[model samples]
Target: MTIGSLLLGSTAALIAVSDARAVTTVAEPDPTEYAKICDVYGSGYVYISGTETCLRIGGYLSYYVGLGDVGLFYHARTSDVRTGEDQGTWQNNTRFTLKAWTGQETELGTLKTYTETRVNFGNRHTSVSDSSRSYAFNGDSILTFAWIQLGGLRVGKDWSAFDMFIGGAGDVLNQTPVPYGALDTNVVQYYFDAGNGFSAVVSLEEGSGVVGTIDNYAPQIVGGLKYTHGWGAITGVAGYDSNYESVAAKVRVDINVTNELLLFGMFGYGSNGKLNDDPMNAIDAHGRGFYKIWGGNWAFWAGAAYELNETTSLNLQLSGDQLKNYGVAANVAYALLPDFTVTAELDYDRYGGSAVGKVKASEVNWTNANKKSSVGGILRFERSF
Candidate 1:
């Protein structure tokens, strides 16, 4: 063979050998490999991620069914219809909620915000039949909770600092946790963290009582301090309500001896600060307190409160007047099974006084004395996931 042909033949053989080796070393990829990758690291409906914001979705749902009798009114004459009737009914208060939270990491710091909405499918009995009928008092869908937490400031509607005096998550029964008078308030607030589970908060809220309408824009100042530790928690609150010029104060303490045992109690007092002859004069104040214990599948709570009786004010003829206010409540609960429970509660109230103020100042009027109370019990079965 010629020299040029010999060189060309060897080059062609080398090219063929390289092509065969490359085909044998490489295998075909599986069609399902891409799907597996997506399942392990791809986005999901419950999660979102982008930029510096990480979001997580979570909330709680509760359904409550109850039957009981509650007092509605009191007759003028003690001998005539002094006590109301025992009305029996069923109720279902269910709620479902959604919450979204977003936080961004920046040079200054991490800024965060959250918003929530809830639908209170109030007791089915409150709804009319297929033929549509609207009930005004039947609670409709609501913006149950919405707030923003940035640095040390929180703005928007939220739980009042004073409301902690009533009860904590330890209470299994919902309605019996707080009295009508000692309720939560929606307001704008600012708080300072003292570290070591201690914090102080001050808030501007509406007046003390619901006079005739709902307007939270009224002027009121509330402040409180809270401290938490492995052994226990304690809180104190003080406030001023300008409508009645009311001065209010409260304190609460809770102790956890073990994982299952707990002891808690709270005391509260409020008084109208204005003089009787003053232009904005309003006289009303009261004191309330309660103690509770729970452990080993059993819970018991008892409460006693008194308010200044305003029954003897100027117009005594039309308004049944007296002086002496009293209230009491007791509750007990036991677990029947892992998922079932039984609860019983007794509540009582006696309204008296020419003016309801601090409990110590209320007077006793023998002629207009009256008593109102009720006994309620329920069995509940709950399944949690």
Candidate 2:
């Protein structure tokens, strides 16, 4: 073969091979469609793709530690009492919460949904039934809030309206928890806005916990009325517990005396009807139900919060019940940074009634008949979005 012909053929063969080895290119997708801001509900919401529904996501993290005297947060575990083991007097906790929100407008009204899930890693409390186990959860993980609302009507799991309408007892870290009236329940509720400064709520609830939950199909009933103004507000709530055929009522007043100072007082009373004296604990001897959480037939709660400055605040709460149960709590909150906060609190409790345990009042650690009083303190650090 001729040199020129051989060179041309080789070059042609190389070109064909190069083309055959070339990588195939797949088709590219179209440009992404940006999400549209949805302002009808609130900030941080964006319209869902291909739909008008608004969606948002948020959460928080918290680290809390506490220590206290006997009968309060710190207690003598069954193991400690039986053996000479080290007393676990401190509680260390870490918690994570996830939340979601959605909103859509409809002919009926504004349709909205909210959900929250909480998980915690901590140590469980053991006054009589258990031994302290390290790194164990104090309580089961929970769906803290899950509810749907269409205008005035709402249904799902949430805090009872009796507490929501009456507001809680200031900002103090009340370790005992009942003074705030922050009880949880599944509810069917309706809200009414009567124009200027007046509103009302009607709720049918299924209570939580063993002693509070209904023993039958009959549901609990609650109603509330509230009036709001520039100088604070006045609110009242009443609940009928079907299980025990008992009734509870609360009245609250809030006075915003100054821009930086806020004060509130609440009084609760109940008819402990249909007493079941079978339980070892006498808490229900007078028929304590879900709505009547305090130790006795009547209880009073008062509290105040003062803004120390732009980044600091102080809070306090005092409460007492007809059964001679008393408690005091105080706290100071400081905003360490934008979305981070640090809070420290002190708590005191005295149980002068037979509501603490199955033991005699003189032998019960919660009773003044033996220990006089119990005290505790906690520190918390939180970050939220």
Candidate 3:
């Protein structure tokens, strides 16, 4: 072949090879992934990557300052000095709470799990003589709630169904002066929703305290039925104390008076009257049962909430029992920001009947002929996310 023809042939072969190489150069797929927002349960949920489950994390921080006779109203031990002496002092507390939730869809129903943890730091009064410090630094931490649910069945630590059914209405501090029922225990529970705002719950609980705790296979039984609508709801719960062989029942009604107003009332009764003389005497033979911790055979609570504006609201509560223990609590809460709130509250308590006589003669000297009432107030600020 001629030299020019050889050069042309070589160049043509090189061009053909370059074309083949270009055709074979395939691009790789992208590997970056982003989290997806989950709207199934509520806000702040996101789907976990490479999984079918959705996860949510949330928390809140709060600081509280209390004034007036807080010790008297909150049942703090007083100084063993002169009669009718005020045992009030300034108090401060800080708390942080963390919560997590996870959910997934299953053939039977939605499977879910929830957890809540809390830590508290406070300058609590250990004794009347030990009140000269500012920050005690002694704090406490607890796993307040941890539970799992599949369809309608749930198992874990939770509030008793007797108290859960007829929940506290207002945001008033110290709502349980008369004591409706005990809270916080391990439970195996099942819930049923009949649709149209009708639901029911049955729970077997490990009662609180040594004597109240289940010694045998017989656990504390709690059952409740609720009817709810756009306006409000009515709920009733009954609890059977296996150890004491007694029963207690509570009925509550909530009314939506207006778009900005709400009202609620609850009444509780116990079968055994002899057991209620001492609210915390659970170890004694005729002790108050786990379900009936009120200082009487019957108790009642009423509360109201009124929204003053979009960012402000007022709440009030009145509670009493047949033993003449009465309490009044009120609070005004204002939202300083989208997820921040400030609240101011006032509380008053009165001791009557045998409790008053005991207070008058006790070493603490909390009450006298003219001093049967105690008043206190608190200011709190909280930020939630």
Candidate 4:
């Protein structure tokens, strides 16, 4: 054979061998990817793929039917806004709430964000017809609670620290006749844990409603302290209203009593003694200010809860203010399923003091001899997921 032909034959043989090897080679399978459950922050959390954060989604639906004079007096609308008129007798409301929480470990500490929103449908009976068939829908889609927290620092719309730190007791439909504080507001706050079951908090907030949004640089301030043990807890909170230049304070104690029973008591005091004069605009007499909300300068609340069994419980509460106004609430709650509950409650309230009486009459037209006294009841059902 010629030398050139021999070289061509050798090269062709090498090319054939390479092609055969390439055809026999197999590719390995890609690594399987799946969602991972996150138990660090508790149940219902799942880790986000390609991210360090974990997220949890939860929500609840509630329906309530109120009988007798259960609805708020302002719910009754009249042709004349100045004078009280009979409009509503019964009230009904349905609510749906959605919440989301995200958490991650960061250099600053455990970083977290929480958000909640609510939608409501309501109806009331009015004098305009045998029964007011009108129903209205409302929503707090604009973030009822949306906050970011790193370590102990938090900033956003949150429940007033003055009330949150101290907390409230009982599951009754009607809150204490004399309120200790208002609801959620814009806040910048910090929480401190001292270890050994002791902690503290300080917050700067923007007052809501007629108290007027903070027009000036001054913001409402709140401070609180709490001590908790295996059997009970003691808590105290104080607030300063910048607009009204007023101060309010609340102290509370909770006792486990027994594995199935709990007892609690609370007291509140406000610096605004003028609350009795103009009950509408007063800090304590009406829910006009951020913290102060009682008929007089001081108020008291006591309650108890007893679990009859794993599925049923009973609760009772009694409240009174320096103005002599008194209220009682009792309820029985039963769990129909793991995530569903039903509750029935009864309430009675009595007006006291001349100023408070007049204010009540102006709102509800309780001109009759027994107008100072009111009775109401509520039936509620809730499902959570």
Candidate 5:
């Protein structure tokens, strides 16, 4: 073979080798991260990327229509309340609540954080300057809960332990027809779960708005103890109102008669004499405190919940205060789907004390206060995720 032919053959061999190398090489796929289910806590939780923490986001949409003397529409109008000029009509409220929960395992225990935000639109409690515009957008708080917990220690905005510990007068739509206790406040609380069936909680709280809030640096104190078993539970709660310098306590007992029936009773006592001193409480004369919200110095509440079936339940509450004020509330809750429920409730209240607000200066009544019997009801629909 000639030298040129030999050189061409070598070039062809080199080209073939280069093409073979190109065909064998492949670019590695870009690194990817996938969401992982974190079932350690429960369903709907996923581990955060690059972290051991688990997060779950959820909320609920609730709609309720109020009728008769319901709390949603019975209050006298701020503009013309003295002459009893009020807007007593059908009222509706729609709320969208968003919630988030984060949890992680730590040496101290479970580190957790929770937040709840709410938005409302409907015929809330507002004076109608333009009679035609009764419905509007309204909300009490955008952020109802923002709390953090390390083990049993929790700090942030939460409902009072006094009301939460005892389950709050059954599952009634109108929890406070006779005013069991205050609901909202900021808290620094600690919980202790004794082995077996005993647990306890102590809380230092900053009371909520106007009449309930603490004026000085001294915080309100509340404590509770509970014992639970298969049959039922016995729970007790007590609170010291720093502002009013009074103490209120409640003791409750629950009995699980059968697999489907549960009965409970609670008794409340408070040094409500201070109520007559404050102008705000003077209107009601029951000495309303953050912890003691009953009509008088003593009160009793009895309630029961019976599971009629898998999808239906019946709940009822009967409450009375020392002043002879009595309330009865009953409701039937039916679950339409996994996360949706509808409840209809009826409430009857017989006012024991005069509703007339007495002015220290004159006998003028501030609100259209009167001792009268009233009937109210609510139809509620809620969907939670």
Candidate 6:
């Protein structure tokens, strides 16, 4: 036999021997170490099997009280209702997650399958509904992630590998993500690690908008590259749509100024020029950047965003000509003790230019059609288990 055939035969023999040994070495149960059972299958399971399996569970909870202004206005260009007020109340956020992995050895190689689910409790009942508590129920907050990995190939429902930056710390805080109308979508992505802190990814995701052209739920392809080091990380992406020949570019950068401070920013542009199919001939540009300072138990952040120019006339008709949205925020916390702590935050938002489009000066509520140029504060008390 050739050398290659000999090697394969020897490997198969070794595996057969190993499996036989494992079966013969199965030990008897020990009464001394008998523990309560958590068996999902079979008669009982005192302990988990050592078959290359893994599990992890983690998440957090948050309760907040906010006092702010919710105002209203008119649609007429001549009307003004900028200064209005509304009521305030308390809100709660509770989330939990569970994840597990199963491992199996196949002819090709070792493979792993994993799935995770997240539950956002209070998300089911929000006071923002126009009617009763039933009306308040919105959003399918339950998120699921599943994937299989064999060698370099991985498929799953997870964060688009093309994402530039994560909003907030992936937490439930008033302004953890600095939301000023941002986009975050799920996708099926493939990633190739280039070693060192650089990597590249390509993904196929559900087109977020502009339906009927691509059969509604058609796939959009996106690709991006990212690099990271001890001090910072940067990412960039380009996306394409087959229907209208559109392309979008997005970029984000995060810098660690010190052990306690962070600086970050993001920018994106979308256009339909590449395909020679400029149906709406649309273009969009938006940018946001912030600097955060941290102390022993206190932190402060200040940032601003500007939408330079928009080709979408609908946006212009609603908000105004020069759309500038900016905000400044700060937070302070005291450990109080190991398991308990108290925190507070303050923020202010300012909207100018054509940014007044959908906002009704007379409606003092916080919605897509209302603009807020006011200040607000939040307080929270937390306990750990």
Question: TM-score of the candidate numbered 5?
Answer: 0.82
Per-residue error (Å), model 3, residue 119: 0.4
Model 1, residue 328: distance off in Å is 7.0
Alpha-carbon runs more than 4 Å astray in model 5: 1-34, 72-87, 125-133, 273-276, 279-286, 354-369
Model 2, 190-284: lDDT tens digits are 99999999999999999888777777889888999999999999999999988778789999999998999999999998776664555654546
lDDT at position 202, candidate 2: 97
My TM-score estimates for the predictions, one after another, are 0.58, 0.83, 0.81, 0.80, 0.82, 0.55
Please report the TM-score between candidate 4 and the true structure: 0.80
lDDT for model 4, please: 0.77
Compose the digit string of candidate 3's lDDT tens values, residues 249-338: 999999999999999999888877344445555333333578976655678999999999999999999988765678898999999998
Q: Which segments of candidate 3 are over 4 A away from where they belong? A: 1-34, 71-87, 127-135, 273-287, 353-371
lDDT of 4 at 290: 61
Rate residue 89 of model 2 by lDDT: 56
TM-score: the better of candidates 3 and 5: 5
Candidate 3: worst-modelled 10 consecutive residues by lDDT = 356-365
- Superposition TM-score, candidate 1 onto the true structure: 0.58
Clashing pairs in 2: none
Number of the candidate with higher TM-score, 3 or 4: 3
Angstrom error of the Cα, residue 190, model 5: value is: 0.8
If the candidates were sorted by their lDDT against the true structure, best first, what order would they fall in? Answer: 5, 3, 2, 4, 1, 6
Model 5 Cα RMSD, Å? 6.1
Q: After superposition, how far is residue 202 of candidate 2 from its true place, in Å?
A: 0.4
